[model samples]
Target: MLSRAARPALRAGASLQTRAVLPSSANFATLREIEGRLKSIKNIEKITNTMKIVASTKLNRAQRAMQDSRVYGKTSNGVFESAETKPVEAENKKKLVVVCSSDKGLCGGIHSGLSRYIRREALENPNFDLVILGEKAKSQLQRTNAKDIVLSFAGVGKDIPTFADAQAIADQIVLLPNEYSHIEIVYNKFINATSYEPAVVEAFSEEAIAASANFSAFEVDEELLSNLREYALANSLYWALTEGHACEISARRNAMDNASKNAGEMINKYQILFNRTRQAVITGELVEIITGATASEDM
Candidate 1:
């Protein structure tokens, strides 16, 4: 009952209706394929989200512990640095390097940062002795073909770190001959919840330790100074473990953030493809019908 002019409008209405209800069968398959991909991305996003939350929680605790440990470490460093203003005793001495890395994996840049820390020290100091704490660090050292390495620790955290763990490492370093004039620590310093940097290579020289024994600094005698020295050494060991833990959580959080973002992007891309493909399918059907009707009219 539609007029000739209205027929074109009717066809347009039909085309729009068809586009809304039924897409091209060819593109239906493509849409389903994209739908499957979207589902995968959704699952990936959920997993990444869970990991990010866990990392966030763990990082908070780690940061608290690191903060608590830093107070003692700062006191040690300040006293030591100030003491350096005094006269020197031992010069041109051997260097001892303590490396702090992780037992578990999945943290971005942490292992690599620690590895390079070792490489830089080994390459720079010929007389340096390495005391690697984690398996990751040990493996990295072997890869660098740095054979002159010592495994100071096996399982740092079978569960979590304790003062005993630090004590064990300190024992090894302390047992080394005093001819190795200085002790240096290489670790990743956690700056914030999402940022970290390769900790400045910190070395404690005998002179610094001696300077810390200044009568002006602490009203203590040689015996007390010796005891305080032992105490400070233990504090240093504990500080490294806490700082390393904090850095690990920060790195894992960052890695998970990237993963979650990538998943969301994939889902968006697939949805766009599905929409465009469905539209193309509707336009194709419309053109086909219009061409057939024009041919019939001409005949």
Candidate 2:
């Protein structure tokens, strides 16, 4: 028989059991929430998959174009490389830093790598002026103390970069007087559809203004070279954007996967507690029935 004090305790225990089960509803809620999240993720997956396919397709073509053009860039370098005098003709020495990065965010290290390049170069040497491409690089470089920056461009929105853009940039840098004439482009060259390396800001040419302004001479017989340079830079730019998207997709996928696993564990834990609560109630009812029968028989 349950004493008066014990009865109160038993009632309290039952109340506690009900309270424990309260959170069990969260299991269903979790299932529902996951379903919604899964739907959204599915949509995002479709978008990412589509982008991946497009980037890879373009990457293949761009890679081939860049490879073909590299031979010409080598030839051009060979002609100028042998020059005995320093080609950067500026009476005063100045460096032009070209910043390349994605306009969009979510790509893992694409922007981060570019920023590091600027910090190491610009912050390391306050002598050079920066030329920023893409919104990320431009926004980041503003925080630096570099001086005499002549040209800064932003908003090269999507892939499929054109020669016009590169030409515009090349033209601007070449126009800088001899003092600020030497130029380097900081960009992530696309290695594969999935991966891109750090920003490479290689000096394109140190040719004085005469050679710098010769677009016609550079492209006269080397149509293929021009095409290659165009795509190579594009490939570098395009690759960074694509790889960034891939990184973001992978991160989100991993996070969602973990959420699903945790939900499953929680559901299992609650089920165990619920089962134990039910068993305890059954045992208590059995004890009361048996004790009441004994009391009546004794009377």
Candidate 3:
């Protein structure tokens, strides 16, 4: 038989106990959520780190391939330079644009840069057709310039591009029914590890080569000119592919490195938050326990 005043105090203490217990349950749930977030961020860091390592390993080989291909391409195109070759521009002459990009992503904006270049060019000259290399560029251009795409290649840039691959692609281009007056290859030109730009390498037709200002200086066999033109196209394609591959690798390494750094920072932030939350929860538990003990003793 408690007095009315004592009953009110007991009810108040019981209400405090209930509120304290509820918060502990909520605290546990919050702690679990923080732990899950921390684990997810850690996993992301691991993936980005692994990607950075792989890109770093591939960069050296890709650079070597690009250098060799560049030299080969220069040598192949020297004859055109010496002859001062120029593309024949006729009203009815068709132009072909070949875009060299990669199949993989996570390489930053390399692919998008190429697509944007082509789109800008298309806006200026809608008469030209496109030949896309790699899925990334193809997928992007398909949305805007689908009608202009005459040919496309996939499974490119998986490794260092081989001369044979270029030859095969050239063969397909040559087999097309329409004879293009000029063939332009668009590729990412690596200026530095972190910088690249879309560039074009021109491949002239035999007619254009024959019309060169200095064509009379060299006595080229009439039959061999066609073969020379084809060989030069292949060389140019190889150069573009190799250079683009190197750029892609470098861009991927940089992207992954940045991702890893950001993930690390996030992990640190989350870790601090988790520790503080845990401490706060512990402190709350301690306060609740002390309050319960004091309440019981007073009773």
Candidate 4:
């Protein structure tokens, strides 16, 4: 019942339809891949945005704590400055170095910078012991100077550091079996919202403070010397901890902000690619249909 010419046209149309279907299936697969990537990027953006908000919220409180602690610490150390107190270095006397860092990471190279400074100091003098406050620094130091670490504290920098926290840490240092001639606290000095530097705050021993050339200038009871030293150490620790916390929060906020921006850029790129690919697929289908229709008319 079918003419020969009609059969040929029918077969040609079926062939063209098959070819179109194959490419369309391939295009769909590619579209699916792109969609998956886009979804993943969106999720990453959400996570980074959330982290940025948290860091921003904590930054204000941390900055306030840092300011208050700075004032308190400066006031406490004024006597030492007036007397020009300096630690007496001796080969037999061991030095204690306390590193102030946080347990949480993702805040740029804050903890790493502190760790590097300690490593440099170790190279200069291996006789000093380490007391790390925070897991990040402790882990880094333990890899190389495990034996030199006398104490390590966790759960620090979760919130603004309090005077009580510093007092407890100072009490532990004072109770150590070995007597240290000098106590140095290493912390991130908050220069601005975007800049910070690792610095040291020295806490001299009772003998060192009294040995200063200008010690006679300050009239003080010998009985109060130990109490004064303990108080000064606590005040310095609190200042260091608060300042370091502020720096960490600022760094984290910046890092998360950058991450979110990158994710948004990736999403935009993928969206464009997806749209272009879909348009190309539609154009290909139209071309196939037009070709098939023209062939049928010729038949």
Worst 10 residues of 4 by lDDT: 13-22
TM-score of each: 0.70, 0.56, 0.94, 0.89
Order candidates by TM-score, high to low: 3, 4, 1, 2
lDDT of 4 by residue, 1-299 (tens): 99986898777877677775667778878989998999999999999999999999999999998999998789877878889898887879999999999899998899999999999998998899999999999999899899999998999988899999999999998888888889999999999988899999999999988787787878777888888889999999999999999999999999999999999999999999999998988998887778777776766
Off by over 4 Å in 3: 1-17
Q: What total of clashing residue pairs does each candidate reach?
A: 0, 2, 0, 0
Superposed Cα RMSD, model 1: 8.2
**Candidate 1 residue-wise lDDT at 157:** 40
Model 1 C-alpha lDDT per residue in residues 64-156, reported as the tens digit of each score: 788888886787777766664332335565566778886778778788887876677666766666777888888788777365675457776
- The model with the greatest TM-score is 3
List of clashing residue pairs for candidate 2? 90-178, 107-244
- What is the TM-score (0 to 1) of candidate 1? 0.70
> Which tens-of-lDDT digit does each residue in 28-134 have in candidate 2?
45655655655565566556555555544554555554555445444544533443223465546767666665576645556667777678775566677776667
Tell me the tens digit of each residue's lDDT in model 3 across 151-192: 999999889999999999998988888889999999999898
Cα-based lDDT for every prediction = 0.71, 0.53, 0.93, 0.91
3 or 4: which has the higher lDDT?
3
- C-alpha RMSD for every candidate: 8.2, 8.5, 2.1, 2.9
How does residue 194 of candidate 3 score in lDDT? 93
Identify the runs in model 2 with alpha carbons over 4 angstroms from their true place: 1-28, 85-92, 145-149, 175-178, 190-299
Error of 4 at 257 (Å): 1.7
